[model samples]
Target: MFQDPGVGVFQAWDYVVFAALFVISSGIGVFFAIKERTKNTSKEFLVGGKQMTCVPVALSLTASFMSAVTVLGTPSDVYRFGGSFIIFSIAYTMMVTLTAELFLPIFYRSGITSTYEYLELRFSKAVRMAATLIYIVQTILYTGVVVYAPALALNQVTGFNLWGSIFATGIVCTFYCTLGGLKAVVWSDVFQMVVMLMGFFTVLIQGTIKNGGPVAVWKAAQEGSRLNVFDFDPDPLRRHTFWTISIGGTFTWLGIYGVNQSTIQRCISCKSEKQAKLALYLNLLGLLVILVCAVFSGLVMYTFYAKCDPWTAGFVSAPDQIMAYFVMDILGHMPGLPGLFVACAFSGTLSTVAASINALATVTYEDFIKYWFKNLSERAGTWISKGLCIVFGVACTTMAVAASYMGGIVQAALSIHGMCGGPMLGLFSLGILFPWTNWKGAAGGLLAGITLSFWAGIGGFVYPAPASKMMPLHLNTSGCELRNSSDILTTLAPTMAPERPALADSWYSMSYLYYSAVGWLATVIAGLVITFLTGPTRGGDIKPVLIRPVCNLLCFWSEEYRKACWCGVEHDAADMDLSGDYISTDILAMRREEPTEISKKDGKDSGDDLPGHIAEDRSYTNAGFTKDTDL
Candidate 1:
């Protein structure tokens, strides 16, 4: 083992940068909660009153997926493997297009509070509850991973105990998410995004200057085969292939951004369905730009440490610590640089955790508690929501404390996401894409999809696979001879990975990147098969949910079908029924008659009976939790 000199310690001002973030975030939370207390309803607390513009939602979306996992894992992955992973941008592109085209209209038009509420309208309450349960499980696990990623990294370089960092992150995020709800979360996320971008420039500019420039970094990465971005091989065992990443990433994001409560809430919160679509589309560009810079930073790290492999030389405990190591190496001399970078990492952590806490609370209140305790007062519901945020915050912190027991946070996070995301995405797709898919079909497909997903995920991730082991790209450690190797090695014994199993050469070695796509296909295929086998529902039964084209595809067969479809939406008067008003089920489980029709038929101007804005103007008030919507 070899070692490099450490970057001594943080100055007093460094602490100031971190402290300011806490104060501002806490104050924002308190300010919003109290300010909105008068006008605040369950709707306001959850979705920011649905008056949001595109930029904030877009930025929040960017912040969600820009977790510490990306900040640390991208650099480590590039260092260990190649930059081919950057092809995931293609996935982001697909997510934007597909979401804008198929998902946004249905979800936005429905005007429901929770994403799972769409399940009840399309299928059954059972499906809604089931999907909600899956989402809860996925997000809770995801929050733990998100919280743990930065805490672990900060611990390695700054000597801040992981436990302390985890607890601190949870407390601050919970406090604000509990107070201001969505507004506070969104504004805090905006602040964090600025800090993240600042950290990006600091590392890139400073690291590039120290490494002799961009050209030098490129040359170093090229020599080590770290710049390979196009691997066309179809082998599932060979991870990071182009098809697997792009296709797999597409489904993974669709599972997350397309159907998850966190991202959907942002879309729902937009001023209009069109605005949500625009914001979601714009989110793609932001993610691409950030990731491109993040990937390059990895190559730059290789440039500076080309002659000193940190993992092999033993300056760090794991490969994930490389980013913090490089930050200290290049920017350590600048008094606040280290703190800024740590802040950047925590920005990802705190924004994501806060977003998750808020979304979890929102869903719990809207989906589960709201239905059972129908008569509960608004104040009591809000308090319960705040309490839920605190509970989830603590749960995430606890998971962080135990996160060390899990393996690589990067792959672990992706796999956990895929394992749950796939099935959930499938359930939503069934409701959106195929109208004939009944509750039975959705339930069966979801169960089977989840089972297959877990089996493949566990076999691929948890179990051993020897032949599939990724050999580290050759390292140039000649420049690392100045320090005594034994001393550093003694403090942290370099992890010698365990031996692989014979199954590594079999189907069990399938890469986790493609798990998202796998889960989605299993669900759709299984859903379609089951729907046909068990007597299918009438085509009329589905017009309320199916995409227009799919519904239109059935028009040639029957006149009744054409008349029955086009379930909602305000179309031209030419298509209006003889009765003189639109009949819509958009307010699922809430209203049976359109307000205009109800008022006219009842012979009274009684529209106030329902919360009218609940239809389109309500959505998630907080930031993009993991996928980055600000509060």
Candidate 2:
């Protein structure tokens, strides 16, 4: 009963449903903008006045990174690479737990806006600015892919102009994000999350019914060799092995959930640290829910195309388009259902793009612009934040147009993360975990890590693995009704092979999944070497609050030994003063110490012992600055 779609497939009701997504998203932004019009300071604009509850923040956290890449690419990946891609679920669990235990505590205690500000506190201004630039580049490139992926799919199925879709999605996202700030972004994310899930479920339920049932789908996958989940081969060159995905994938996602500013901004916006932790754990559950839906959707696609394989039949030009084609072919008769799927992809686009744009604006204002204009007004800063959102939104939308020429949506996005993330993750890890690493080490390590990642990632792109090495699991076009005998043979024929290169010469042949791991290791190793050569930072020079102890695993050691192992910095009882959840005891003690004690301890005037920046910025008593001077 299925027929190929030669033109646009969306019905009148389908357009209505699709249009409603933007309307609702824009409305949420307007509501928040109006509500907070009286007091839309920089703090309120950036972090919702730090009074947000856990639920919206949690949903926003999950929705921030769960863009069209996951919705469209995950299914396409599983269908082509087998169910081994599901191993990423393990990676997901690892990243969330590690982030919760190790990273969140320090972030909540600091109460900072820009995540990169911690870089300055731990290292120096140069390192902080370097990290900020890297984040900006990584986010812009990734947002491009996020916007482009859904637009490409829409173009394929509905004959929508690709650029029009990109601008429409981008403009709507920019409108809401610029109008309402973080509150609008978070609430819109919550609303969009619902729409996205509904769309995914519509495709899954309808597609499963058309394919018979779960058992039949599984059987089809098994026959097609698409159920290869437990591939334990230890070869690094093999594409989708369990170790590569689980281990390398852990570092890849850790770069996102652990230290990336997009999720960090949402997490720290909550009213308290406890609320922030709750949001992270809840985000884990949301991630697993979306993961299951995406993986199952891939399986359903495999069931329908088990014998025909849409790509080889020339029904679709790319693997990414297969999901869109399946939606139109299967759900086309149902009118608004196909529109729901489109809405799903667009919801993902809006949430992710909006989050990235907001976070970018935050870092630009807090890290770069604020220092330049010390006398900038609160009202001016708020307007600047909105203006920055518009600027980033337009820039990202333009990049989306450029991202169209790239290959395989999932791989491209993850590779970008791995290449940039590994270095950024390495920089943060060096600063937080090892107190001995000085500014030289931090700067050198970041540079080296990025160099290696790009060399490998770019090399891999230029000289891709040979067809024999990178070939997909057996896909057949034997059942395609439109294909004649000759056509089928041509579709299935093997092309002439290029001469095989030597293993030593083919470093780029390493699985793309391991790019993050490679970059991370390069950074750590290079960093330690540079630190030792440049004379490691003394324990006295580092702050205890900035260092996270890695000695939790030393249960067999004595308490004193564990304490000594942690940054080797001595902490007196008076070092930490906790007011509410934000800890700044040591900082306050320095400022409030008796004049005689200050003279005795540092041989300097009272308050002169504090760092110049800290003393100059009087509002920096709590974490970095007080409410009166946060901007």
Candidate 3:
């Protein structure tokens, strides 16, 4: 029973919700930008002075990763297919473990601001440059996808112009990110995450109440076979098989959160390594909770429209617009709900793009610019960094126009992530796990990785295939126009049944779920094999804990892991450099000596060492300015 949709258009209350968000976000940026204007250093501008708390940082991580693609796309997946997407919990679990146990200790112990800077230390500058460029491209594409997804949905719901929405979002996101830098981005994320949660919860709860309840929603979804989650099929060609999704998701997440700059930037900003770990763990929990809400919303959506489904009944244009249609269908008459829904969707968009812009600017400045512009002043550098943020933000907005041509929001976004993520992650993996993978090997592997990744990612899009429709849980023709068979919901085919071409490559039809893993393996295998062919660099600049193998497996343990992986690097109490969870009298002694060292150097302690997790604050010093710069 899809009613007149114009009734759900933006009311004054709706405009107020969006207006308040812009005012608050820009205000925070201005406040922070002005407050830290005195610092005038890339460190402070990029990394929040490295004194962030666990909670805000955790919430920021939550907000940064949950793009509008997830906000809108996940529910669409659930409503269309079933509960299989919930398996992402498995992926997140693996991601949390891999990130915390392996990747976190590596990056945190290195005391890095940019994740790829580790590449330069571990391999060569070429490898670092390669990774940075890949990341920049990926973030640019992803920011567009993030912006485009919700803008499209909102346009469908409220009749707002899509291009206008995109540009407006770009302008607002660029303004705050350019002005406030990381602190502004994090604080705004904390606030927007609250809005996102409230909006999602409201929709799910309201939709559930209107459609009967949770139990009814569940029963309705299950009856249609849309509730199937555990498909252990080993077929590589199938779309959502368990092996493909789980391992692929794990690798995908590892690529995104483990080695990527955006997540690592947040992790490093924490007060200490332990606090960073806390943020990562809390982010995992937050993702689990949010994903549950999204899946439930999908169930309610399916049940509500099981019989007189709007899409089948000619009430909607595209599958991606289904959630927006549901918003109007159930919550339209409510004065502020429709606007809140739009606000909620765009909140995800803004948080994601804002974080990417800030982080991208940071990486560009640190990894790409700092060494090149040796004589750049702190003031000049700050402005340039801000300029980069604005430039990337605008570029991202421009790309959103192209992303509208992609299929579904979630898949399109994930496809972009995997294409770059797999190769980037592979480069890092080769650095840590394989000592012989020198710059030659890394460069070769990177190229091969990207080639194969793009092939796997884009090939399916190019090859036209007929979709195999699946039977829905329920369908009714009672309220449908019944003008044609295509408008019938239950009669729609599943995604697996694509129309075959004369030369349809089953290989190209490999599931997107397997993309990250496939691309990762492609790069690593190519790099490893090519490493030996290139006469292997032998021994590496990587830290011991980075390549420290799993010593003592199944009671067959030993202390010889030192000679196992990267060679000559042994695990000692000194390995605490790799893990902050360790404490000792010597570490305590070193900590006690730090302030004394600072006091003696600055004479009267000019307060260079600000408290929490204090280290030598590398400020304008890197840009040819001495530590004793005149204020």
Candidate 4:
């Protein structure tokens, strides 16, 4: 058996290369951020001035989706659970399409800076606050865990302390985000994605060549049963059956792409609705590429070290470090290769971290602070966002330190996102679909959904044991052991406990795909029931334009309400003639003409009276509705 290579194997060149890459990427981000400062209107700062192209936006989305947890943890997942995890990609594809078709149009049409603004439009201020708060909590926790995972991997490969790595990463991310805004984030993401993909494919190719080519690698994976993708058992208790994976995984993806600001923020920054849709398609293609590369990487690693078994041999204490181990040990001697790989890993980590920081800062500034400080100036708001980004960066770093101690870092991060994401998506859906659902119902239902999800997620931790004390009904009792003989039962006996089974502490341990479903169903049912019990509101209050197009298409507007109400006034216009070209001439003609019944009946009076401010504002409004309202 080959002896394990300890952490000392990482040379000084690794650190030098990683540091240089970090400095260069971060410097570019800072330069962009400084350039942005001069032209930094609220729109530009928050959403890259809403003029991003599809390629950069798609790359940013890919970078954000493929975080450090993805880089380090995905291979570990394949190594541990076989290839069934690839089935989750189906759910991801469905969610991205749904977001492009259903969610993106509403957000773009509304012209809102933050996604949670829809909650205020559809529900009440309370629901918006609740959703934003939940997002902040979820993003911070998820970012922290993702930040921690790579640090853990680096710690295993190099001798650098995990906490130190976390601090260094957080500081670099914080600096660029504070300086640059969304523009910096997007550009950095483009650079990061290129580096990360190159590094990943390079490692995969190198590993494949070393393992006697693709044929031998596939043969080994098949021999070890690592190639199984379709397991269609009907057991909900099983972690990765086709049914559980598809249904739960779809909802999980929906929560991230449909509602989460980190991903949607990129989509909303696109130049047009068509570009946003195109970005979604590109993201789907990228996801497919990521899955294929990541799985192949794992298969190659398994084949190379089939006999040595690094974790069991004590080279690394955790499965998460397996990828790192292979990279450092196998590719260490190749000049500049280790540096490129480490740089790529750090680039992925920083890109996602920067995006998360920028998004959270935007949400906090627009949703929470601005809600209370109504008269805040534009410059003051900008400064507030910058401060918040720094504060959020530090908070995430602290959480990263905490996450380093946890098991299954990727699963934990995804689970946290899934738990909170469901309610946010449900709240948004209600806002679009059910016009009758009032603020009280929305607020109450959102609270109920969040509470239920949290309890379900934390229940086992709080309760600590089963009531019967005879093995817990829902827990798995199976065990794995190293066999000394051909008899399976005898080989597994040592690993098996006589009386009790241990609980899985990994975040992905219990399928997280179900978390979003639970939250979504709870929120929908509770919101609907509460709305029914309470009486519906009168017509004037409902804003049809603010509602989702699908919802508006299904619900008919009353003729009486349509004419008298302010809600659908814009919709009544035949050609939306809010332009001011005829303002000077038309107003003069109206003033000279007789104040007859003809004007009143034709709604010409409303059209002709153009105050100086009104004419200019209307001209701008004709350009596009300003998203300056609280909602």
Candidate 4 lDDT, 89-192, residue by residue in tens: 88888898889877876676555678887676556667777788888988888888878877876776666787898899899899888888888888888888
What's the alpha carbon RMSD for model 3?
6.1
Model 3 scores a C-alpha lDDT of: 0.76
TM-score of each: 0.88, 0.91, 0.87, 0.82
- The stretch of ten residues in a row with the least summed lDDT in candidate 4 is 469-478
Best by lDDT: 2
Residue-by-residue lDDT tens digits, candidate 3, 1-631? 3434343666778778767777888898899988988888878889887778789998888888887887888888888778888899999989987887778866765556888877776777778887888899999988888998888887877778989999989999999998888999999999889888988988998998997888888888888677888889787776676776788888888899999898999887766677788889999998898888888888888888777666666677667888988887777788787777778888888899999998899899988787688667778988999899988988999999889888888888888888889888888888766766767888888899899888878887777332431223344547546546654544465555556565455756777766788778888888988888877764433344335333323223433443453354433445343322222222233344443443344464332342212234532122111122111
lDDT-better candidate, 2 vs 3: 2
Give the candidate number with the greatest TM-score.
Answer: 2
Select the stronger candidate by TM-score from 2 and 3. 2
Question: So what's the TM-score on candidate 4?
Answer: 0.82
Candidate 1: RMSD to truth: 5.5
Quote the lDDT for 53 in model 3: 77
Question: What lDDT is reached at residue 586 by model 1?
Answer: 33
Q: Rank the candidates by TM-score, best first.
A: 2, 1, 3, 4
The model with the greater TM-score, 3 or 4, is 3
